[model samples]
Target: MTIAPSDSALAPALRGYADHKPDHLARLHKIEGQVRGLTRMVDDDRYCIDVLTQITAATHALQEVALGLLDDHIRHCVQEAVRADQDTGETKYAELTIALRRALRL
Candidate 1:
């Protein structure tokens, strides 16, 4: 889900990944191409192991993007919130913990 800053009072004026948004978009586009390739491979009845390998590659790429975003969030968004106030600090940290759990699939 895409949330604009206007959508939430707590939202930052600029996103954590703003500085590297272009890089992220490029990575996402590459991942999109990888997914399309995987679909084509399946349509062509390619070997099972090859398809799985491509799937793994795509998954890892996505995970890398996720990690990069997460790192940016910590360095920018969460840090700013914490520096602003104690309540916001606690809130952001809790939110970060939840996000980490979800990322880890714990």
Candidate 2:
């Protein structure tokens, strides 16, 4: 159930800025390795508790990445929208609400 951004009159508040820094990329790569390790754990019939712990760590890492991106969005895009008197800020807020709901599987 992918939720794409609506193409309304409001300009998109989320724009592609600079690419991820080397450190960020390295962190993501490590997370990817962790995910692969989980797959290997399942294949090797590892204990359930161990797998669950790895999953918890992976979830935290992903959440950290998300929060960083959200902070950037609030600082740059959302702030600009509010200053320009554009509808983008409200739309962005709604988008954030939907994203949180989806992320939490609520």
Task: Please state the error at residue 14 of candidate 2 in Å.
Answer: 9.1
Best by lDDT: 1
Question: Which 10 residues in a row give candidate 2 its minimum summed lDDT?
Answer: 13-22
Residue pairs whose backbone atoms clash in candidate 1: none
Pairs clashing in candidate 2? none
lDDT of 2: 0.73
**CA-lDDT, candidates in order:** 0.88, 0.73
Report the C-alpha lDDT of model 2 over 32-87, residue by residue, as the tens digit: 99999999999999999999999999989987776766666666656776777656
Error of 2 at 4 (Å): 10
Off by over 4 Å in 2: 1-23, 103-106
C-alpha RMSD of candidate 2: 4.6
Which stretches of candidate 1 lie above 4 Å from their native place?
A: 1-13
